[model samples]
Target: MQPDSSTGLNGKGQDLKIVSLISIGQHPASGRARRAEQDGRAVELGMTLAASSSTQNLTVLHAGDSQQAALRSYAGMGLESVRVLQLRESADAVKTLSEYLHKHAPDIILTGVRAESGESSGMMPYLLGESLGWPVVSRIADIVSIKEGVAEILQALPRGQRRALTVRLPFIASVDNAAPEPRQSAFGPANRAFMEQQQCHSEPDTARNGWSIVSARKRPKRLKIVKAKTAADRFKAATAKPQGAGGKIMKNQPAAEQAQAIFDLLLEEGVLR
Candidate 1:
């Protein structure tokens, strides 16, 4: 899909295209979750883009991988139709995906904060945007509005607060869980999508060079894995333990006395010089 040509003041012409990233296959843990949220956010943003367009014209493309499960999940989002681009699993996945995206040149591209596999790299959107000479907005929660070739975006920060940003057209934004929940697909549409397979054309491999893979008998664990049936159960497990609880509360003591008491306690605990 090509970018629409009806240039507004912000230079985004009519008939803008929105592209979403999809995982090729099953990832170990949070990988799927991250990708799912990203896809959902993409659809949510697309819906917003669709609403704001006077022509009501938009195209949704799915940069697909071999992961049938991930593809189906994305297909079921009940948004616009998906255009799938198949890339070799062993090839430089990022480069291949970027190349397809560049060919399409969608006005606004939406991706997940991170993928669920290899390096868990959250770098695709940024790297792709840099390669395409487009701006990138990470951790987007909402698309407030689009007009005159610019998009107003809402982003969730480390705290509970959200910040608003306005980016020019042809930009990339990585969606986070802060975006709307992904819609479920009706069985009919999903089945139809499977029947109507989208064809992908291979481009010259621009994959990077100089890479090494070292096999190891064991890899160090980055985080402890725990399985829980419910959100409450997960919360319970996380907050189950308390640390360093015992402390003297010297209330109603003189200022100097309190300082001495703290010093004595520190010395007793072998925490002082």
Candidate 2:
């Protein structure tokens, strides 16, 4: 999709483009209701960009039911209107999303790193990029500037590092958590927002059903020590892997010997030391 230069400028003298902010609500069962906040970090990121002076026009899009309560929650956040392409529960979401994007041909598309429900494959940006043949910028913290066809952006990296990059226009970007948090949705604006719905034919790809569902669980916390005092120390601390427990096993040993071996292994592993 090419960005039309004529339609690119806003009254504020900033270059403009049709920025599509794709949003998905977290499934009610996804443990988000307890927080009383919608589970769409990507939507917030897109909202932030849409509110900026850089974008002349912004359109919010969703593939599911337009009337979903969670969608209204997004409207309350700041969007004036949201367009929905009704999608069945089992429909091929990627295909449907691509079709709508093709028809609208937005110059810039923004999405979250991953969805809060379903497979949460975190591959939407990649898939959309592939389908639209557009360059994708991941973990974007900020868009510094967009002149002509190139955009300068700041990327968030591990260890609190930031990287600057430039990419051509008509691209997809995945927002990083490092970006500023979004403002809370106001009840008044949310009530005034309009929702536009469109019908689309999309069938489920049964092949996706073959995938296994795993129970969600909390990850064990890793023990970290601030052993670094200087730049070199910090580098070493960042690169070094924690040592694993050390032990020895005895196979087919006599009872007496096995007991002794077990005691020795405990000491070797520092369990008894």
Alpha-carbon lDDT, every model:
0.65, 0.70
Residues 1-273, model 1: lDDT tens digits? 323343432324466666666554334443353335565667666766665556544455554453455565555655435665665544455566677677767788888787655445588887887778788898999887666667778998865679999887778888888888777756666555542245555444344334453322344544546699999998887887544467678889899999998889889856687
Mind giving the per-residue lDDT tens digits that candidate 2 earns over 154-206? 89997678999988778888878777666677888988998888899998969
TM-score, one value per model: 0.63, 0.71
The numbered model that scores best in lDDT is 2
Error of 2 at 81 (Å): 0.9
User: What is residue 203's positional error in candidate 2, in angstroms?
Assistant: 1.6
